[model samples]
Target: MSREAAAPGLGHNGGPPLEDPDPDAGYRAYVWRRAHRKAWKTPPPEIALRRLARAEELGMSYKAYTLEILERGRYL
Candidate 1:
């Protein structure tokens, strides 16, 4: 687990934190989801869509639409 993950749970005094799913399992599915999932750092889908629509209103092509967003996103 990472430090950011620990701080939220660390506020617990002594007895126990909120609760762990299991001693060994430890929120297995939840952890897996966090590990595998990715999120945008810059413009999100809604923002991108708005930009695309505005660009199209200006008559940008499909290639140009994609090109404009290419630099704005990290490769998946």
Candidate 2:
């Protein structure tokens, strides 16, 4: 059997094919990823240390605590 037939879900490079084949969709995804990453920029060191300590005390991860703050604009 040929390589394509051997791998049912894989593309030419043996990876999953793009779910959305439109070039504009790819560009929009890239932009959304960049903006999402930018939204998670590191806070000032003092604030970051405080948040980390609070997160630990609350038995939560730094990311989870921060995401909560970003979504609700409040501390837990």
Candidate 3:
């Protein structure tokens, strides 16, 4: 059935009923995702130059090094 057709909170639950529009929860999630995206995106030119230098010192291309850090959270 379509999502609109499905019952809200129909699954088995032991806790109290959930809030339909939990504004606080939604806002917290939005802020968390926004910060995560900002952290992953390329930085300003000066910072980027530093990253490039570090990547060169690591003997890897800048793109490869950046993707590695973003994915593995550390150098190999």
Candidate 4:
């Protein structure tokens, strides 16, 4: 089935919550998802390649290091 054909929250736990939209942030998010998907598609950047290299030297994969930095909110 197509992604759009699927429910937004189907298979998420029992299913989508039966609640009404917030009417404020909900519509904003809908528009943002459609208009800005490409803008947010890629990873932030590789300006931190030097840091990534260090992580690699220390036996960490780039993916792991990137996630760690982002999780720590230190995207340096």
State which candidate has the highest lDDT.
2
Question: Which lDDT values do the candidates have, in the order given?
Answer: 0.60, 0.87, 0.80, 0.68
Say which candidate scores most in TM-score: 2
Error of 2 at 73 (Å): 4.6
| Model 4 deviation from the true structure expressed as Cα RMSD, one decimal place | 9.1
Candidate 4, residue 60: the lDDT equals 86
Q: Across residues 9-70, which tens digit of lDDT does each residue of candidate 4 receive? A: 65577655789767699788888788566433455457456766778787888767766765
Better of 2 and 4 by lDDT: 2
Off by over 4 Å in 1: 1-42, 62-76
Tens-place lDDT digits, model 1, residues 8-28 = 455566566466657657588
Greater-TM-score candidate between 2 and 4:
2
Q: Alpha-carbon error at 76 in model 3, in Å?
A: 12
lDDT (Cα, 0-100) at 38 in candidate 1: 37
Residue-by-residue lDDT tens digits, candidate 3, 1-76: 8986654566646565565766699889999899788877878999789879999998999888878877888755
Candidate 3 residue pairs in backbone clash:
none
Candidate 3 — what's its lDDT?
Answer: 0.80
Give the runs in model 2 whose Cα sits over 4 Å from its true position: 1-24
lDDT of 2 by residue, 2-72 (tens): 98677766446666667857769888999989978886988899999999999999999999999998889
TM-scores of all predicted structures: 0.26, 0.52, 0.44, 0.38
